[model samples]
Target: MEWHNSLAFAQDQDINDEFAAFREEFLFPQNNGKDVIYLCGNSLGLQPKAVVEEITKQLSSWQQLGVEGWFNGSDPWLQYHRKLAAPIANIVGAKDSEVTVMSSLTVNLHLLLVSFYKPAKKKYKILMEGGAFPSDQYAIESQVRFHGFDPEDAIIEVFPPEGEYTLRTEDIVAAIEANADDLALVLFSGINYYTGQFFDIETITQAAHERGIPAGFDLAHAVGNVNLKLHDWNVDFACWCSYKYMNSGPGGISGIFVHEQHHRDSTLNRFAGWWGYKLNERFKMTQGFVPEAGAEGWQVSTSPILLMASLHASLQLFERAGSVAKLRQKADRLTAYLEYLINGINKDLGTEQYKIITPAQQSARGSQLSIICKSNGKKIFDKLLDQGVIGDWREPDVIRLAPVPLYNTFTDVYHAAEIMKEAASATA
Candidate 1:
């Protein structure tokens, strides 16, 4: 699809976009009393207009029912999480029973590690990408120490080759094989947060399984942004947060996917709570920890209905928008337009002033473009914000702009690029 760097072309595209109306369903931040072009969905998505009604419904239930809200409300707090399973399962490409809404991302990571990271005598190491989100690094480090292994020895990090910004799929598979003798588990993020490079989960998972190691992923960046088939990929486990591309509110609920093959594995350990007990037998309060079947069994506490409510609102939109497959159709074009416009900016300047580090292939990335500024990176980013073009700034030099399919329009992309060009010129 050839893209033109003109406002008329962008407006014409928006006129034909079937997903254009979704932009009105979200509330955006204002600058000078007008909606800012919000390209920060990679950080936190714009709130859905339906969120108010969803939360109010739950608040009303709590006000009227008190302790009885658990079982008596219209959408019972007791089974609220069950409503989320089907929708989220659809987003991550898992069966309904294979997924469950639960704790935040890092917390879920720790819970899953307890079950899948079973270290044998010599096979205690975990392999992961270098420069993963700090939360993952800290969690893996502590988990290794808890098992009495030094983190420096027990954690294997696969770094990109010198001067490169992303990992090669073959290199990742090679790392899994090279460490096959000592690796107890292979864990990775579905997309790297900084570079926005989408990993090849299916290939990575297969490599680990062949070596008799379980594979897991933190899908915080990829869950709603890219196409994932966790079930077909034979991933042992995965977790994701709902606040980014899913458009749930800040610090919203996270979810987990545990393959059906792991459902009845009684040998696995869990940090259990009463909520995870067999549903019918739960009220009995009898002793031994009998977990519910499927992914729900990983629950370690009572469900937070408010958070679930927030996510339900957004998932309803996802359902209305059809599958991630459908969403990706629009996302690919929108992202490509942004990339085209940014490249045009560098071309006009006759220099590589803004360098895109994200993968050029649409199949290898999602809706984000990570641009590294040659000079005045922070000032340029600040100018974008002041002008009401809101993308996020990473430390050092990179600026991440995500033109989300659910809300952002092609015109927004055009205006943002125009502002960015102006910012670059002014800063220069």
Candidate 2:
């Protein structure tokens, strides 16, 4: 695809886009009476237009049915979460039985760690990417302490050598092999939240399995942004928050995937609760715990219907958009175009004033491009925000711009770049 910096070219792309109509499905934040160029889906997704309708239906069920809503409503509260399994499964490339929506991301991570992170004698360490989201670092550190191990010794983080911003697959695989004997688990983010680099999950999973280690991922950034195949890749366990690319509201419902191979493993440990009890026997209130088969067995509390409703609203849009594979086609082009436009800005300024740290390869990234402003970094970011170009800024130097395929347009990208150029020029 030949690149153009003109607004007319962007308009032409939008006119030809098959998913162009999806832009109207979301409600964007306003800045000075206009929709801000929303490039922050990687932080919090825009609210879906159908979210109100979905939540209202649930509220009405509660209003009329009262206590009987659990079983008597059109969409029974008891089994409401089951409806989400198929659609959520499609988004993450897993079988319905292997996936379940439940507690928040960090909570689910701790729950899964209980089952998969059994350290035996000398084999007690975990391998992960360095500079992971702080929540993951905290969760892993706490889990290690809970088992009476020093974090500095038990958690091995693989960092990029010196100046590189992302991890190479060969380096990651080598680290796994070098520490294979002592590693109890291999946990990684499907995409680094800061760098926007999508790791090779299948290769990483295979490396761990060959060494008899259980492999898992935090898909908070990768879930709806890139294609995943947890079931086919033989991932042992994984979890993600839906508020990001899935377009659920802030702090929305989280989901998990436990490979079917472990679903029937009676020896596995879990923090089970009444909600995870065998459905038929749940009302019996039996003394002995009999978990419902499959990933549903991991549920620890009653389903939060409202959060699920918010997620259901967004999942419907994903279903309508076909699959992540299809979304990625548009995402790759949009990100590339944004990359081209940013490069043009630097060229026009006659120097490298903005440096993109995210990988250039389509296969290695998702919808985001992380840029490092060489000078006046935060000042330029603030100016972009004031001008209604709403990308997120990280500490020190990075600004993340995500051209989401669902709600973001080529025109949005073009306008955002123009604003960015103006901001950079003003700083100069």
Candidate 3:
């Protein structure tokens, strides 16, 4: 696999991209009179062109089917969720039965905790990363309190050493082992939302299982960003949002995974609702809670048909891409090219001017490269936005730039760097 090191190389790669035709499938924002270089797919993916057709089909169904839409219509509203199971399963690395489309990410997180986090008096602690997403932090705090324990004592947040931007694999393993006796569950993000660090999930799962603790993940940033093997890794359960890498719109449906081993455990507790009832006999309206087996049992509300339709269109595109491996190969090369361009720009500007904080190594991170601006982060970021290069800002000094394999091009990355180099020189 040879790669060219110049802008022409990136342009040539795009010219020869087997998936290049798929670029027209989304709407990219234009600045002044041309398309802006979009590297913020880490936060929100570009919309799929097919989404309009999918949404239109559902609206037509609503108009034509009328009262019969619930049962008699084409792609009945009652069974709408079934259509998405197989495709959603592909991206998350699980069997079709092991995955299901459901509520928003945070909502699914709370529902999953109801079933997985069973803390005993002796083993009452939950393990997580210290700087998790703010929403996750709130969820953990409330869950700990719900268990009749104070968060300060029941939730153990593992942290990297001082001055470090990410956690080491060894440090994470040690934290799990040291707290094994009292740890009830190990819940973590597959990719850190801010730093773009990818954890060694296999090692973490192995360590947790050794202690008889169930392991789970919040894959909000990772489901579409990285390759996974949820079943092979024996992860007890996991949840993810599709709006980012899946190209679904804001607040799109989320997904869940549950290994087969736990599928029939009636003893595991859940906050039951009508939709979770056995699908075949759900309309029978029995007296007892006869939960459906597999991940579908986690569903608590009626399917959102319009949203599922939008997601279905995006999943079709993923299916055509030939799984995560195909996209990953391009991602590695494209992100590496972006890093190369940024470093060259920084060298020309001087070390005191700017720096790339994202990992220099490939295996440790995803497409997002977080750059620490030398001076005002917000000012530089605003200037870039003004110039039509759109990236995202984190807290103090880092700007996160993500080049998505599905729709982003190497040319986009190159142009973003050139714009930044200009902005840095002008601001100075």
Instruction: Name the candidate that leads on lDDT.
Output: 2
Which scores better on TM-score, 2 or 3? 2
Please give the lDDT score for candidate 1: 0.94
- State model 3's lDDT: 0.86
lDDT of each: 0.94, 0.95, 0.86
Worst 10 residues of 2 by lDDT: 285-294
Q: List the residue pairs that clash in candidate 3.
A: none
lDDT of 3 by residue, 1-428 (tens): 45544688779888987778778888989999888888888888888999999989889989998867889766888878888887777778889899999989999999999989999999989999989999999998999899899999999998888988788888988998999999999999998888888888888999999989999999988887788889899999999899988888888999889888888998889988888889899989889888887888888998888888888889889988888778887887788888877778777877645667667777777788878887877888999999898889988888999899998887887778788888888777
Off by over 4 Å in 3: 1-5
lDDT (10s digit) by residue, model 1, range 1-428: 87888889999999999888888889989999999999999999999999999999999999999989999979989889999999898999999999999889999999999999999889999999999999999999999999999999999999999999999999999999998999999999999999999999999999999999999999999989999999999999999999999988899999999999999998998999988999989999999999998999999899988888989989999999999999999999999999999999999999888999999999999999999999999999999999999999999999999999999999999999999999999999
Number of clashes recorded per candidate: 0, 0, 0
TM-score of each: 0.99, 0.99, 0.97
What TM value does model 2 have? 0.99
Steric clash pairs (candidate 2): none
Q: Which 10-residue span in candidate 3 carries the lowest summed lDDT?
A: 350-359
